[model samples]
Target: MAKPWFRVKRFGYGAGLPCAWQGWVVLAAHLALLIAASALLTGRPLPLSIVVITSTLGVVWIAWKTSDAPWRWRDGGED
Candidate 1:
């Protein structure tokens, strides 16, 4: 029997969002942490933004490379 659409797996995870809801949620939390950590470490906003943006971009790139679907979409077949 075939698996249900929602139960299909992709991108090393059970696919949801293009980047996966799991990745977006994790990235959001990581950004929040980066904000706090950079602020505490540098006592400045510029470095905080820079670090957060860089890290966020890196994560986004990784998510994009690992995902098989387009942004905001999902696929059921392995790619």
Candidate 2:
């Protein structure tokens, strides 16, 4: 078993939202942000958009961390 902090069920909601289902909503939001950012960045050359690159990196990191955490499906969605 993994620590609660390392669990995917614990990844989605925090501070403001506490429900496990909220996590899925948050995850989807992040995915959408990533897609939008990527589309915007594609219009410009890499060298001209450091901000987009940084933002994309941050988004990727969040997405990666969320997915990396073990989703405790056995818990039926609870952490």
Candidate 3:
């Protein structure tokens, strides 16, 4: 299998910072999308909301799929 782009957080219940260039690219793209959407969809509340929500879910999905391990509560202990 391919190496994961994100690593599980050591003290939380989710993925942490990017562990690969691909992950960084994904994060940057997501941010750019949100910014562009907000700027372009201003004054259109419905469309803005849709774009934000969809983009958020899409990013979460990508992180989960590319994470080094499944997300779960962590106490900073060795697995």
Candidate 4:
């Protein structure tokens, strides 16, 4: 199988920072989209909310799919 782009967080219930360039690109693009959406959708609460929520879900889905391990609560113990 291909190497994962993200590593599971040691003390959280989700993926951590990017472990590969591809992951970094994904993160950067997501952030850029959010910023652009906020700037363009200012004063439009409904559209802004929809864009933010959809972008968030898209990022989460990408992270989950590219993570090295399944997400779960962690106490910093060896897995």
Candidate 5:
């Protein structure tokens, strides 16, 4: 029989590695900020323009910096 807490612990949200998760989290935060900035600046719904520009820059930055392969990346899936 498996312990109840074990299941909960193993199945916890965002089971991936910390470093990998950190990168994703940072990216998400940056995107959200840009989206919010656009919405606030443009005073329009969705704010896709800022999202696009911010996304482009974010992606490029990640892609270039991550190419070294030294960056710690958490697994997308739980162990």
Candidate 6:
């Protein structure tokens, strides 16, 4: 059987935060860069795109932590 999307994201964690705020900071920066660049290049509504992407990453992080697969180091998929 194929691995589910949640399994593929198991390695998403890199830092251990003291609280949810810190965790969100890490996720926010990663997402902000992506959303900002995409918005600029595509001529989309920048602020709205940032907010939506940031929210989406937060939810994805939540689901990822709650999923059955164990947490693996976020190595950026590098060796």
Better by lDDT, candidate 6 or 3: 3
Off by over 4 Å in 6: 1-44, 71-79
lDDT of 1 by residue, 1-79 (tens): 1221122244344334433465666667776888677768686777777777777777666565554444442344544
> What are the models' TM-scores?
0.43, 0.35, 0.94, 0.93, 0.38, 0.33
Indicate the TM-score of model 2.
0.35
Candidate 3, residue 10: the lDDT equals 96
Which 10 successive residues of model 5 have the least lDDT summed? 1-10
Sort order, lDDT high to low: 4, 3, 1, 6, 5, 2
For residues 1-79, what per-residue lDDT tens digits would candidate 4 score against the true structure?
Answer: 3989999999979999999999999989989998999999989999999998998898899999999999999999999
Using TM-score as the measure, name the better of candidate 3 and candidate 4: 3
lDDT of 3 by residue, 7-63 (tens): 999997999999999999999999999899989988999999999899889988999
Q: Name the lDDT value of residue 74 in candidate 2.
A: 47
Best by TM-score: 3
Model 5 accuracy (lDDT, Cα): 0.49
Cα misplacement distance, residue 21 of candidate 5 (Å): 2.0
Question: What tens digits encode model 6's per-residue C-alpha lDDT throughout 7-55?
Answer: 3342465324324444456557657766677766575567667766777
Q: Go through the candidates in order and give the clash count of each.
A: 0, 1, 0, 0, 1, 0
Cα lDDT, model 1, residue 46: 79
Q: Measured by TM-score, how close is model 4 to the native structure?
A: 0.93
lDDT by candidate, in order shown: 0.56, 0.47, 0.92, 0.92, 0.49, 0.54
**Candidate 4: where are CA atoms >4 Å away?**
none
| Candidate 2: tens digits of C-alpha lDDT, residues 23-62 | 4555566568657766876767664366556655764454
lDDT of 5 by residue, 7-55 (tens): 1113333222224554566567777887677767675545666566767
